[model samples]
Target: MSSHQSPFTHPNDSSYGSLQTPDDSEQAVVSEEDQEPGPENADTDSTFGGSLLGCDTDTLASYITDYKYENGRQYHSYRDGEYWGPNDEHANELQDLAHHMYLMTLEGRLHHAPIVNPHNILDVGTGTGIWAIEMADAYPSAYVVGTDLSPTQPLFVPPNCAFEIEDCNMEWTYPKNHFDLIHIRELFGCVVDWDDFFQQAFTHTKPGGYVEILEHAVTPVSDDDTVDANHFFTKWGETVIGLGEKFGKSFTIWEESKARMEQAGFVDVVEKRYKWPMNGWPSPQHRTHGDDGGKSWKRLRELGVWNQLRLYDGVEGFMIRLLTTVGGWSYEAAQLFLAEMRINLKDFNTHAYLGVTVVYGRKPGLSRTASTETSSTETGSTKTDSSGFTVHPMPKSNFPGSYRGMT
Candidate 1:
């Protein structure tokens, strides 16, 4: 694919085709005008007219008014309509911290791909565009593009990096086979069609280019019996999985992504799994030789504390409205459930953890032949004996979104 050749043609000179709601359940016209505003389009509702995270007015309004606010947190008001995730200042701050968590999980590396000296990089669903900015700074010569629904990204990004308002579910407009590396993360609920998403990724990837997906199971897991079937955390997971099913998307994407990549014709697919401890009980990194329980215990307690704090607001920011609006729970009921969930998170004895999967695969080269035998591999070792905080391998027979035993 030529860098100069575009993959999609806009329906209108100043706008693309109508913006389909996130779940593809509805449609509305969303202007795709240039980010700059001129006198002719000034004050038009077709474009955003107010300052949003320092984004230009036109960029702010380009999205359909699919926005809603609850409890001081802003949310995407588009279809599948239950994204309780926030796009406010606090959310952005948590995103930055979450980026650090990802780095820590990956052992301080940005990504695990072997690509070298690539010029073009695309980050799909690049919330806050923090990864793009950091990648741009690291790879000075590469032009990085971050695409997302909201314009909450910083205005003073590196010159090599730029942000675009895009829906990953739609036909991408970038040149096919142009990006050296494409990255997507935490898009569990937003994408309705995983197969098409991977197909598009394959099409836009340069021959021999790499695409990586970083996602975690939204459902909580516990190796020990501490997290009972009736526990609030377990119920919360059930509700989230149920909601994903109701909307036709799957929340347990990481569990099925490897097979999806292979099905999409990607080669050399590799998957790595990590554990995200809900509290300090499952973290082996924070332990050391027994002192008087002063420094080590404090550090471990801090880990648990921060995880609790992040989860407290994070779960509310993602579930309160989702449960009330989509799950038919009343506002008061949602609040009560959230309060219980927060308390459960604070209880380190539960030993709950979420599985984080990082998978990367390459587009086959024009001259290379696809091998049918053992085309992919999983590098993550299953640990079931580590202090009862095990990270189980995804079952080979079961995939996400099947809704088995979720109710």
Candidate 2:
């Protein structure tokens, strides 16, 4: 599948989820009926190839297109049976670890240099709004907004925290020459357009304001042991890329963020890559992380995969089995893999040389910056190196991108 824009980017594997029906299972997955295309156009495109039922793109869109805000905080759901969650939103090992990592990013700002007079901040595809809520508490002076499509968020939140139910792939609604910082984490590889997304950020940002993005270098940056050519994660990544191209997204938008930001007239763009060990390994750094970090990594793996696994359930019949059965290994194996992943999360680590790429840029002080006018058509492009892996930019302008690219 070319990384060109389309709507079949991710796969759907729910057919087998129903096939594994136990005689006494309680989660009544309606096997006979196909996915009803939510509240929108459920009546239209009702049939798959006029009769079949697999990988219903329209249906998936309708299912995830709800984001609401109330009080001060935000909320979202992990599609219980589909992908991840029915579990606690906050206070989890993985979320806690994620929070810790986020806090590290905030140290320079939160405790060291207090954010003052900042006009606005954005949390793209804010899942549970946990990060935003925390930031809201930390920076009560700024208006922090989170956007997502699911209304499964909390009705009450921090005084400064607000949520919006806007599809980021569409036209951004914020005024131009606004916003101080835009923080988006974990939306890499799935964002549809890097150019437009960065362009809007540049336009909205107050020239010196920063835009920080934290994303895992999933290609597995390693020192001693590189990611295997045929590892499960690699294969899954390829599958996701193929599916993303089919679904109007590229699903591999991590590599091109810096370039896109530069193109959008951002300056002082800096990239920080870090190795994340799969588990606390033989190295002292790994030892320091210990079980405390390992458990958090394990949960992250489970949630990340589960969150997007259901999208494939619509097309591939055996897909559900592949993910839940064979793909679902014992906890021990996950621990090992996660250990390696964590070690590799950083650059030039003693244990493993793997790391995530943390990139940020300040919007250019262009006096005549272009306005955020959404694109009418979706498009994409990517670059690759010696390895089979490649990177593409996910530009989110005012609109004309996938509303659910990062969902």
* Best-matching candidate per TM-score: 1
- Candidate 2: regions farther than 4 A off: 1-97, 104-116, 230-233, 282-354, 366-407
Q: Model 1 compared with the native: what TM-score?
A: 0.71
Residues 346-384, model 1: lDDT tens digits? 776676767778999999984222222213343366333
lDDT of 1: 0.68
Candidate 2 residue-wise lDDT, 262-321, digit = tens: 888877787754444433333333322332223343333332333222212211221222
Please list the Cα RMSD from the true structure of every candidate, rounded to 1 decimal place: 14.7, 18.5
* lDDT at 270, model 1: 90
lDDT for position 304 in model 1: 46
How well does model 2 score by local distance difference test? 0.47
Local distance difference test values of all predictions, in order:
0.68, 0.47
